[model samples]
Target: MLQLKVIQEVITLILFVVFSLVFFKNETLKWNPIIGMCFLVLAAYFIFKK
Candidate 1:
């Protein structure tokens, strides 16, 4: 379970970075809210994780 938590954190972080890059690279991509949401969900998930 602890391993799962760590993995989730890592994955979420990766996703955040990827999304930010994509948003930056593409003007058509509106990633503000999506990035915000990903971070928020990751934070909540980790905070509540055992």
Candidate 2:
């Protein structure tokens, strides 16, 4: 149950950023956010890396 919740949160975070980048023309992808997203993805990877 806990693992599922963590996965969902990570996916949600990624999707939110992706959707924002796709739908919001005014919003540009900056370096800081990109780095943050990379870290988030890494966290997700570690979580599932059994």
What TM-score do all the candidates reach, one by one? 0.47, 0.70
Model 2 CA lDDT for position 42:
84
Model 2 weakest 10-residue run by lDDT: 1-10
**Model 2 shows how many backbone clashes?**
0
lDDT of 2: 0.84
What TM value does model 1 have? 0.47
Off by over 4 Å in 1: 26-50
Please provide, for model 2 over 1-50, each residue's C-alpha lDDT reduced to its tens digit, 9 standing for 90 to 100: 76788788878888988899889979888899889878877877888799
Best by the lDDT measure: 2
lDDT, model 2, position 2: 65
RMSD of each: 5.0, 1.6
lDDT of 1 by residue, 1-50 (tens): 76667667667766876887787776454688568667767766776678
Q: What lDDT does candidate 1 reach at residue 16?
A: 71
